[model samples]
Target: MKISILCVGRIKEKYWNDAIDEYSKRLSRYCKLEICQVADEKTPDKAPEALENQIKAKEGARLMAKMDPAALKVALAIDGKKLDSPGLAAGIEKAGLSGISHIQFIIGGSLGLSEEVLRASDKRLSFSDMTFPHQMMRVILLEQIYRAYKITSGEPYHK
Candidate 1:
């Protein structure tokens, strides 16, 4: 299986990059992993709802452009379905069994994903109801995916 993390913006901080690299290395054993980043739109402080929507739309367009048409798209949203590690593992396993060779997980910018992006996704997942920094969320998502793989393989790391 091939897993792609398609997100907005870059991870400028070294610590976040390190965490991502660690997970990427660990995940290499299970499947091919790719991290794709799109340019993020600048948002004014205390911006109005309309302006925020516009920014999200621009970012969403960029994400959609990079999306793989044949891959299963999963969007990360606060209101998305919440799943446990085993459940995620089951979903990933099921996808592979069903002949889904690739899965693309989408992480939006600070303003969140646009309606078009959300509608394009095959699944919407939520780590938590509270909002998280998009950069940090990437790391968290990677770790969960790693855990999911471990769980699927009946490995000891998941505990």
Candidate 2:
């Protein structure tokens, strides 16, 4: 299976990059992994709701442009379904069994995903109700994906 993470903005901090690299290396054994980033729109401090929405829309458009239409799209949202690690593993396994060769996970910018991206997704997942920094979320998502693979394979790492 091929797994791709599509997110807005780049990880500028070295620590975050290191964490991502570690998970990427570990995940290489299970499936092909790709991380694609889109440029983020600048948001003014204390921006109005309308302005925030506009920023999200612009970022969403950039994300959509890079999306693979053929792949299963999963968007990450605070209100999305919450799943345990084993559940995520099962879901991924089922997708592959059903002949899905690729799964693309979308992570939005600080303002969150636009309606267009959310509506286009096959699934929406939430790690927690509390908001997280998008850069940190990338590493967390990678680790969970790795754990999912390990769980699917009945490996000891998942514990």
Candidate 3:
């Protein structure tokens, strides 16, 4: 299985990159773990909140285009469905059994993902209802993905 993490914005913090890289390496044993970074949209200094989302939407489209059409898309958003470790493991197992060749996890910019991307996704998952910075979210997502793989493979990483 190929697990691709598509995210908006670069990991500017060294710590964030280091943490995500650690999990990415761990996940590679179970499947291909790839991280795709897209340019973050610039927040207009004078735009209203509604207009801000439009900027994010434009960038979201670019990110969506980079994803493989055959892959199972999972967009990360605050309003998305929340799942625990076990639930995530179950979803991965089902995907694997279903012969999903790839799984693309989309992470939007500061304003969140556009409706089009959300509609294109097979699943929408939220780490929490509380908002997180996009950079931090990358590391968190990577860790959870590694843990999920460990859980499925009977590996000791999860414990």
**What would the per-residue lDDT of candidate 1 be over residues 1-159, giving only the tens digit for each residue?**
999999999989999999999999999999999999999999999999999999999999999998998999999999899999999999999999999999999999999999999999999999999999999999999999999999999898836
Better of 1 and 3 by TM-score: 1
lDDT of 2 by residue, 36-114 (tens): 9999998889999999999999999999998888999999999999999999999999999999999999999999999
Worst 10 residues of 1 by lDDT: 150-159
lDDT of 2 at 159: 61
**Candidate with maximal lDDT:** 1
- The per-residue C-alpha lDDT of model 3 at residue 19 equals 94
Off by over 4 Å in 1: none
For model 3, how does the per-residue alpha-carbon lDDT over 1-159 read when each residue is reduced to its tens digit?
A: 988989888878889888987888778788988888888877877889789878878887888789798999999988889999878988988998999989999999888898889888989999997999988888888888888888888877635
**Could you give me the TM-score of model 2 versus the true structure?**
0.98
lDDT of all predictions? 0.96, 0.95, 0.87
Determine the C-alpha RMSD for candidate 1 after optimal superposition of all C-alphas.
Answer: 0.7
TM-scores for every predicted model: 0.98, 0.98, 0.93
